[model samples]
Target: MPSETQLAYFLQQLLNAAPLSALYAMLAFGYSLSFALTKRADFTPGALFAFAGQVFVYFTAFGYDRLWLVYPAALALGVAASLAYTMLASTLTGSKVIRPLSQMSPNSVITASLAIMIVLMELVRIAANTRDLWLSPFLNQRITFWDHPGFPVVMTQIQIMNALAMAAIVFAAAYILQRSRQGRNWRAVSDDPFAAALLGIDPGRVIVFAGLTTAAFSAISGIMATAYYGSMDFGAGLMFGLKVVMIAAIGDQSSPARSAAGAALFGLAETFWGAYMPYVWRDLAMFSTLVVLAVVMRQERRV
Candidate 1:
């Protein structure tokens, strides 16, 4: 049996890790969505994540002080921007120009994705004046619970909403992939585009659909992240995108559910490390584990 102090510490870590885990899960899902169709991790989502948050901030700033009206406007703009980018990236990558190259070499598709990410990030920087943009602080209020001697667990309203949103997104993605006709089409294309097309499914259309869905996931993630942090920085999206890629790689890029599970585990590890270890070593420790996982996965695939 654990002592009271140990139990309190564990509970505190759980509360702190919940929101971060949800964010990683959603981000990993976005990666999985694109991978399902292209068999390549889509770096486009990193830009979309940053773009959505920046656009949201821009629109809210444009609205001046009328938050009720501005918030919706901001959300719409962010969603639109994310969708637009996803479409463009998906179409280009799936186009005849890039599709042939993708078949010959995975590097080609990854390069295109990286290029798109850079372009979008530059665009965002230009629009946001290369600075950290702020959002209204309404969601930053914390709700304290589970009071203990020298250990109190607290969660922000935004964090709660973020957690709920992640759950819904994950559920919806699983449902679509598992039960829906469109999802069946996506899987068919994923398995073999030529074969799927022979069966009358448009591979292009399925790819586009997958890209759009992934964009939607990234848009929601960006919005929630901005709301939770109360600010958006230029590099946040890039870092986030990279982290999700790591999580997906560690979990298995081919399986979104597995990737999400890996993300949750990573989140838990991160929380515990932050609480118990020095802050500087936290990322090193997490990333070292990721490297080990990647190697193990590679060896497993070989077997």
Candidate 2:
């Protein structure tokens, strides 16, 4: 049995994990949506995530200094710029790269997507001049949930808001995927693009829809993450993208709800690992687990 202090600490850690889990779940939801359509593990979303966050930071800094604007005004401008550029990038990739290479092998698509990731990372690095930019923190007031003699469970206001926001987006996306006509088209295309095309559904258009929707998700998450963490670096995109890919692959990638659930579990695992184990080994352990799961699943399929 756990003591009062131990239980309180446990609760505190759980609360801390909520926001992280939500972020992973949100990214996985977006990734799974497009992965279903493309039938390939596209690395573009990760790059877009990093790109959008960095772009927001860059423009916000510009607006704050060059335009002599307040934080709110600068943030608004940053949001607008991030959304515009992310969607444009996603559209171009979907049309020029993803669509054109659809008939090629999955490895071909993965290679092209990785190449795009590198290009976007370079663009971000060059634009920032290899500088790390940061935002002023806001809504950081701590909210205590359970108070005890030696331990108290608490979370920041912003963390709670971000978690709630991610949950809303996931639920909304699941609803759209299950109940909407466009959702039907997305699933149909994922199952059989040729059959969908024969049914008068343009597979290319479905891919465009997935791209745009995913861009929106990436932009929202990127902006929020930058606002919360004060900074987003160039290398974060690929790592985040890869982590979400692994999480989504563990779930039914074609189903948003299942993917989100899987991501949430990953998030909790990460948080718990950080708390109980050597923090340095957190990523290595989680990643190793994912790799093992992938290999086992493959072997099962073969059997």
User: For candidate 2, what is the TM-score?
Assistant: 0.95
Please give the distance, in angstroms, between residue 149's alpha carbon in candidate 1 and its true position after superposition: 4.0
- lDDT per residue for candidate 2 within 232-256, as digits (tens), equals 8888888998888888888766777
Off by over 4 Å in 2: 299-303
After superposition, the stretches of candidate 1 with alpha carbons farther than 4 Å from their true spots are 1-5, 65-106
The numbered model that scores best in TM-score is 2
lDDT of 1 by residue, 234-280 (tens): 76666777778878888888777888888888888998999989999
In order of appearance, the predictions have TM-scores of 0.86, 0.95
Q: Clashes in model 2: which pairs?
A: none
